[model samples]
Target: MDVFRLHFDIDGGSFASAGNASVEVKKTLRQLGVSNAVIRRCSIAMYEGEINMVIHADGGTADVEVYPDRIVMVLEDHGPGIPDVELAMKEGYSTATEQIHNMGFGAGMGLPNMKRSSDDLKIETKVGVGTKITMVVRL
Candidate 1:
């Protein structure tokens, strides 16, 4: 199959609309006959990334490329960059505000869940700049 590409503009701080991109991607994958397991992984990872963008970054962009043997997701944001990647990787470590916690998010599982769900994950960030996350799942 030819490579399929999908793009979405994630709105920051919009709890109500979070995960829309992941949902759309899941639907597209289903229409393309992707396995449920793979779809679930992609959806979970993408949803986590989307939530991170909403919670941390003001907004961002998500891009997905679907190939015959794999799917790649790239999430980019222009928010404050993560200061400590190692610390952020740890489960249950978060810097979110109490307001965010009240909304049922900011549990510090976003990055961990992304890593657990993706076959390969890469994170790039700079202090005071932004962050970019790329994840790949093999078919």
Candidate 2:
């Protein structure tokens, strides 16, 4: 099977550049003739991951691998790791500060939304280290 890959560095501390990776990936997938439905799901999941990397981790890396039957998105960040992943996964549980809330984000939907948009999801985090999240979407 043919493969299409994309890599992006998410810039932390700047909300202005958030979601850039997702936008570029969407364009790349469209150019590759990926279906709109799959592109939408992939973009949404990537965008949410990007936003999280920005608001929490300061910055991170996102790698997207697209295959004939599925797409995988990996996001890695060197931020304060989540203390409780289960609680963080809840619909309205967010640890974002008021500054982030002022930006209209941190509603606690990022992980949940990512899970909803992807066929499979995995997250690994260490309190003092960082976080790595892998999300897969079936094509």
Candidate 3:
């Protein structure tokens, strides 16, 4: 099949709509006949990235490319960049505010879950600038 692409504008600070992009991507993968396991992995990774963007950044853009052999998800945001990726990658480490914690959304598991769910993960960030995360799931 030819490559299929999807784009979404994530509304930052909108917890109510946080997982919309991932849900749409999941639906599209199912329609494309992607395997359940692959779809689940992609969905989980995408959802985590989307949540991070909503909680940390003001908003962001998510682009997904579905290929015959793999699905690529790229999430980019203009929020404050991660200071220490290594620390952030560790489970249970987060900088979310108390309000975020009270919302039951920030457990510092976003990056870790994204890493676990994707076949490959790449992160690019600049302090005070923004962050870009790329994740791939084999199909």
Candidate 4:
């Protein structure tokens, strides 16, 4: 069994740079010979999280740990925090402003998509403090 770890900082308030970390991770996974399906699932979930960080929070940190049997990703941010985690997890329920929606984002699918793609997902958020999300995928 082997383990590989990776880290990235998501820049806040930059739509253009959002999801870049996930893109890099995807490339790294490909180079590491990870399966396409697994890589795709991870990338999709990570990308969504990255976008959320940019849109909702003022950027965040992404940590990925790859093990022989599974992969885990942790995303942490110190933003306004989620007022209602359950509501935030709903699809098509957005708290974004008109500007974000105008940019083709804030469709409110990030958390839901992340849950769907990962084998396990955990979210810790404090109102007015921040949020931390951990997602795991089986290999």
- C-alpha lDDT (0 to 100) for residue 48 of candidate 2: 94
TM-score of 3: 0.98
List ranges where model 4 is wrong by over 4 Å: none
Q: Candidate 2, residues 1-139: lDDT per residue as tens digits?
A: 6788889989997899888899999999899888999999999999999999998999999999988988999999999999999999999899999988998998999999999999999999999899999999988
Error of 2 at 42 (Å): 0.7
Residue 138 local lDDT, model 2:
88
Rank ordering of all candidates by lDDT, starting from the highest: 1, 3, 2, 4
Better of 1 and 4 by lDDT: 1
Total backbone clashes of candidate 4, pairs 3 or more residues apart or in separate chains: 0
| lDDT (C-alpha) at residue 13 in model 4 | 71
Model 2: per-residue Cα lDDT at residue 111: 95
Greater TM-score among 1 and 4 belongs to: 1
| Cα misplacement distance, residue 127 of candidate 2 (Å) | 0.8
* lDDT per residue (tens digit) for residues 26-103 in model 1: 999999999999999999999999999999998899999999899999999999999999999999999999999998
- Would you give me the overall lDDT of model 3? 0.94
Give each model a TM-score: 0.98, 0.97, 0.98, 0.96
Q: Write the per-residue lDDT of candidate 4 for residues 69-118, one digit (tens) a residue.
A: 88899999999889889998999999989999999988888899999999
Identify the candidate with maximal lDDT: 1
What TM-score number comes out for model 2? 0.97
| Residue 50 displacement (Å), model 3 | 0.5
Per-candidate local distance difference test: 0.96, 0.93, 0.94, 0.92
